[model samples]
Target: METSAQGITPPAAVYEIAGRRFEVGARGFADAVAEAHAAHQRPRCMCLVVGVEMYVARLGGGYIVKRMPGTGSHHAPDCPSYEPPAEFSGLGQVLGSAIIEDPAAGETTLKLDFPLTKMPGRSTIPPTGSEGDSVSSTGTRLSLRGLLHYLWDQAELTRWHPGFAGKRTWATVRRHLLHAAEHKIARGEALLARLYVPEPFSIEERDAINSRRLAQWQSAVPSPGKPQQLMLLICEVKEIVPARYGCKAIVKHIPDQAFAIDERLYRRLGRRFEAELALWGASDDVHMVMIATFGVCSAGLPAIHELSLMPVTAQWLPIKNSFEHQLVGQLVADRRSFIKGIRYHLQGGRGLATAVLTDSGDAVMPMFIGLAEEGKLPKAEAVANAVGMGAAAAWIWRPGVGPMPPFPPMQRARSLIRCA
Candidate 1:
């Protein structure tokens, strides 16, 4: 029945996040702005639901009433809204105290770790020689690849438990993520506007869905007085078929449209991400995701300047192989909060933790999974020596290790998990 200073609707009720009590929602969540748009000028209510401040986000069907996660304000550990510590994921490295949040305004300001602009006909990945003061500026930024991981992590697409079996899908992911991003403001623009996720392509919905996609790229279109700009586009990969000159990617949504890549970029993509391609091709469930920057040419073709690819599990969490998927299965069976690791800039075959598991009772665990005969045990040891910090303890598994080592029973006091 009321609007905040920004004119956004309010949540249905306030649940005290920390106290586990109903603080606000007895009447209703959202309502049509009464005829008296300016007639009611009540001071803002701080948007606090329960004890933890909550914001009204418009996503999915109409609106979702959710709270800010990991502020120790979420209702319980098992709640889908609960978040693991950033240090448990690569988030701590990229965020490095660079994000500022305003609960009252329902907005977040994030410091990025990469550049967004590129001149026409040239790549701006920054040559190694020009990487001046790289170490000093590293904390304030994220690599293009790292940014993709951060978004997936923040969207909770990485979370899984036994109860979610067969429930995840691309459409649900698109909705939850678009909603997760509703309040994120980046570089003075709505982050939702800058990030594009192609809607599922279908003959029946093609006209309606494609028409709404323009708003995502309105800034990239040429205006009479203003020049065109390039923005990011993320989509599922259909195939990277070989084209006449290089390779052409058949993106999932825009079947009628294809993005062409030059010989150089294509070779780089194939070489660096060969493992990803193998995994995608070997299974019907694996999904390949690509992120790139592009602009429309005079002829209306989308020309890509830079691109990268990653493989995610059926559930959309990033993974490298079946072994990592096995580890994800174990964690989910136990209802633990964990982070999936991505090899952004790391060397191939280097031993990095397959994933990090956060147990409510025990300390944070960095886990390694492999066949002992595959030489992964040593690799895990090497990774520990390489990135020697943050993990409370190391957990290792291999082929002959019949079942996984036991985990502490799920903590019941602060849990909200409806199923195991």
Candidate 2:
């Protein structure tokens, strides 16, 4: 059985609610949560001496604890809600500008550069090779790819630990993605309402799943003289094959369903994500994750409008190149806790941490991979600047220079699992 580090149970999560200390899973915890929600009282997570504040969110009929806005990094590294600082990744660029959080309302408003609706009789513009490479020129709007990256980050799919191996299934991923979409608004519509993440396939429940899917998709179906309402789809790509007229994307878990893609969009997709496609094709363990805006045609066919692809390891950690693949492999083998960095809207040449070592005591260590441009090594100043804000120190690995360097020393292994 999977155990935390060396099998010791970490301290149970404790919170100070309404001036009283309560442990999660303890008796009366539910009552405390309900009271806090009804009284609008924010619970403080007692992970550290000062404690980090959290908010109660209603999920279904019950409530869940969520980290407050901009407070993820303040929690202890071993805390279940710990998140690496935004400066270590492209999230720093868009946190307050493109993404705005209202702590009171518990909602996030996103300014997207892409459209959620497509007009009938109008041709969709094919994406250029550099469309999602960097933040929009205004630096205040998220690109289609940026939005996908944000969702992935918010879902905490970027985090990894040894105990999670073989447990991160489609069901787990879908649950987290849906939870992340809650209370998020894009273009004045609730993101959760517009997002569809396929449920894990179950032969016993296939018909029920299909029925729910069709019912949810009706909102996006085209009607006479009406603009096509588009919905967001996040799924694993099974294959892209030739259909009778145009190409189609066969998504995993949905065996008999496929999303149609036009010739122009298909060609552009090939050009825009050639590296990602090649990397995915090279490894059987790699998962090709696709995020797209899709709408149902008059004939009930789902057609893709704008989309982006990201390659992740079997553990679902995002990786861009062979170097990242190697780095992530070593981290997993070593059984360390870390957050994988994602390039939301940053260009390929821009410096970003590969991962942040959270198990290290006190301060987090940011790992950097130096990508040589044209035949020249990256400047030391540039790498330092990337590692400057919020990081304790830097772990540099220049693949072109030599083999991977040793990772920074980690604190003694301790269980992060806690029981109330």
lDDT of 1 by residue, 88-143 (tens): 34455545345566644646776655455545445533223221111123445545
lDDT value for model 2:
0.80
Residues 209-317, candidate 2: write the lDDT tens digits: 9999999999999888888899999999999877899999999999978999988888877877788888888989899998888999767789998887888998889
Candidate 2 lDDT score at position 403: 86
User: Candidates' lDDT values, in order?
Assistant: 0.56, 0.80
Model 2 residue 229 lDDT score = 90
Predicted structure 1, TM vs. truth: 0.69
What lDDT does model 1 reach? 0.56
The residue-level lDDT of candidate 2 at 272 comes to: 77
After superposing candidate 1, which stretches have Cα over 4 Å from the reference? 1-14, 17-20, 23-76, 96-98, 124-137, 214-218, 222-227, 330-395, 398-411, 414-420
Please provide the root mean square deviation of candidate 1 (C-alpha atoms, Å): 9.4
Range of the 10 consecutive residues with the lowest summed lDDT in candidate 1: 1-10
lDDT at residue 261 of model 2 (Cα atoms): 91
lDDT of 2 at 79: 74
Clashing pairs in 2: none
